[model samples]
Target: MAKTVLVINSGSSSIKYQLVDLESGEGLASGLVEKIGEPSDGHYKHEFNGEKHELEEPIPDHEVGLKRVLGFFEEYGPSLKNSGIVAVGHRVVQGGSVFPKPALVTDKTIAQVKNLAVLAPLHNGPEATGAEVMRALLPDTPQVFVFDSSFFFQLPKYASTYALNKEIADQYHIRRYGAHGTSHEYVGSQVPDLIGKPAEGLKQIVLHIGNGASASAQISGKPVETSMGLTPLEGLVMGGRTGDIDPAVVFHLIRNAHMSVDELDTLFNKHSGLMGMTGHGDMREIHKMIAAGDENAKLALDVYVHRIVGYIGNYAAQMGGVDVITFTAGVGENDEIVRRMVAHKLSPFGVKLDEKKNDTRSKEPRIISEPDSKITLCIIPTNEELSIARQSATIADQGDSYGNTFTK
Candidate 1:
């Protein structure tokens, strides 16, 4: 039997999971459970061996939702008892400064994660709940919490620090703890192998452009600067987030518009970005609208491309120079138009996109820049689950001692 790791990403009302074979880096099974504790019926779907099974019922809490997941695993196949599960990895969005890397879950660490919920109120609580439930159910299995902020935790002080009052900033633990770090770290690691360069001296920028986008600049396989800050909302304009907005806007809305903080939060996090500008968050829909001569949609694309190109140039300069720029995640991988526009804007940097290569699509990593381009552009699919699994398994194999070293 092959050793496997189960990676779980729990949200406020959903749980996304995958069981990956550690040796092959292939997901043997994956599934999702959604709508937990909602007024309506909850949903569960499990896939294994190219087959999918779904169920709808009331899932009262993470415990119940996870129980159903295990039940499905038993019924469908790949019995957890038989499968060689080395560790259960949970994706915790906010590790704060306390957790600089993935940590082995314990009663104490679980409490610590819950406390950090203040930083990621919408994410860490549910994630800890899921981890607690999984720990209870799988008493013998090692459970690791892989943090989204971990990869950027070691960022230079200048890059992570904010230009705010030191007293208040220190008290609040406010700094640039970037999101999508697992994706960025994983993609950055692959660059050395793909580009036939050593990791030590390479300068790279990774664009993880998903529904929630973030960019990072890595020098010698370590992050120096990243787009996201104290919270994910501080980064690139996302599907619904009004990223990098002036802080005064909050006070302006509160005093002039009589908007409550909660209302502004909802507006910025849920109603803004491409959705706010074009009335559609999906890029594909935006493209269709642009084709239909919708000026708003066209302008939205321009703004989106502009923000990305700005970050690329900013990161390049910050790193002194960039050798490879890799695009990953949903938008970065599939949306060639966005890539084309961003690449063309970088003609000054000698970024020459191979039009033919950019048009062709593949799941595998490939170079999208012309052979003679000054900077190499690549589209590498990010596998956060595999990255989490591998990290989790390493810690598990070395026992609690390995994880303790990282925590210190």
Candidate 2:
């Protein structure tokens, strides 16, 4: 009987979860409950053993959503007791500066997660809620927290600081704390193996392009700089995030547009980026709209690529030069058009996209760069749940370094 870990990634309105086998590195069961608290169109979709199921119901809150999740596990295969779940791991978006590594969740840890909600309001509260519910439902199961910022917790100060009033910034604990850290950490290390080189000696850039996008520069498997700053809203353009916007714009909206601070926050955090550009946050829909002669969609695509190129160029410069570059997450793994567009802009940086390879799509990771391209270009699908599970098992191992879980 192999040990399994349950991984949960709780967001403002959703929870993505998976049960991963530590021995095989396989997701035995996975699902997502989204549109949480919505009056309508809320549901959970579960996938297991090549089968899928959907339940449409009004999930008034995280507690209700989690209750339904447990119900599904009982109704579905792989019973929790039979599955041998030894630990539960959570993906917390903001752990502040206190946690530089994955932590065993406790009452103090839950309180701290709430304390940092000011840093990631949309994420931390919901994550904390999910953790509390999980603990109550599975009281015996040890819960662990794997922070999204832990990967870049040791970021170089020069790259992490803002040019604001030093005293004010320090007072508010303002500094760059990058997000999507587990994905970056997972894929960044895989680069060396894919390229047949040592990870510690390589200079790399990881582009995690999805609804929420970011770029991270690594020297020897450690993050030196990343696109996201202080919060997930910084760096590259995202589905509904205004990344790298001029700071003056916030004040401009407040004074000129008469938008309140909360309104401004919602504007930048929820209604900006591709959503603001083309009135759609999904890339697939944006592409469909673009095919129908939608100029706004076209502009959104251009701006999206433009912002990504800017970060890639900057990261490359920050690292002096980049040896390997990877594209991961939703858009990077599936959208050929976006990949081609991104790689085209990066031609100057020795990222020569193999057109056939760029168009070729597969679930397996593979290089899409030309034979002689100086920078190795590849597509490595990110598995954040697996990453969290691995970290959780390690944290729960209790002095056993050889946890036997497949690290991948």
Candidate 3:
């Protein structure tokens, strides 16, 4: 029997999970448990053997959510008792500067993740909760952690720095630590195969646009710069999160508007971006609203694409020039309007959009750049769970790397 790796991406309100065969790199089962803590709208959607099933249940906490997950496996997995489960891997958003790569999860690792919660307030908190629950439920199984900020570990010193007092910034470890790293790493690994060249020899820009968006510039397989900084909010406009706002605006809100720090933080982190701009965060709905003559939706779409175009241009200049520009994630892979709009805005840079190709849906990579365009444009869907599972299996083979898994 083939060994299986269970990958879990614990979020504030949901968990995205998959079971992959380590040797063949094939998904055995994959699904998501969404809207936890709400009785009416919460459920687990499981997909296996080309079939999907949804079960409604009340899950009040991460522990309850995870128990429901295990219940699903008990009823659906090959064997409830012995299914050859080799390892479990988690996607941790912030590992601080300590972890440059995926590490086998340990008690120390869990504690370290907890310590870094302040860095990624929304992500690390739930991830640590999920880790603790898994430790209790699956005591014998090994768990590994893949840091979301690990890919930006390659950010050049200049791009990573902020114009702040050296002492204060150093004490706080305040520098750009990019997010959506697994997606970037997946793109970087696949670039050589897709373009038929050495990855280390290319100047590339990866636009990972989804609910959360970011742009990263890679020079010779190393990340020199990225749009997201310090937090996930420092890049291109996103669904429900504000990106790249002037610092003065915060001060004005605090002093002139009499807003508290907590209020200011929530304003930018929760109630800003496309949601704040148009009252809709889902790009598909925003696009629909625009077509239906909603001015706010139209403006949000314009601003979102404009920000992406600006980043592409800036990265092109920073890299001297860009050889290839690739788009991945939700909006990049499926949103035709976003793809065309962004490519059209970048036409002045000798990047032309192939309309027919841009409008099509393809699981395989499809280049939407005009034949004569200088910059190659393509869409490559990201697979982060597969990346985590592979990393976990490698670490599992090299036992003792994560100390001992919390032995009961």
- Assess the local accuracy of residue 406 in candidate 3 as a C-alpha lDDT between 0 and 100: 30
lDDT digits (tens) for residues 259-327 of candidate 2: 998998999988999999888899999999999999999999999999888888888888898898899
- Candidate 3's C-alpha runs over 4 A off are 38-41, 80-83, 399-408
Q: Is candidate 1 or candidate 3 better by TM-score?
A: 1
Instruction: lDDT winner between 2 and 3, please give it.
Output: 2
Ranking by lDDT: 1, 2, 3
Q: Against the true structure, candidate 2 has what lDDT? A: 0.88
Please identify which of the two predictions, 1 or 2, would achieve the higher lDDT against the true structure. 1
Model 3 lDDT tens row, 1-408: 778888898998999889887777778888898887775768789887788889877778888888878887877764425657777889999877877777767777788898899899989988988888887888888878889998898788899999999999999988899999988888877877887778776999999999999999998878988998888989899988889989999888888899998898888987899999988889999988988999999989999998998998899899999999999999999998998888888887788888999988888876788889988898999988888888787776675444543332
Off by over 4 Å in 1: 400-408
- Per-prediction count of colliding residue pairs? 0, 1, 0
lDDT per residue (tens digit) for residues 51-133 in model 1: 99999999899999999999888999789888999899999999999988788988888999999998888999999999999
| Ranking of candidates on TM-score, top first | 1, 2, 3
What are the clashing pairs of model 1? none
RMSD, one per candidate, in order: 2.0, 3.4, 2.1
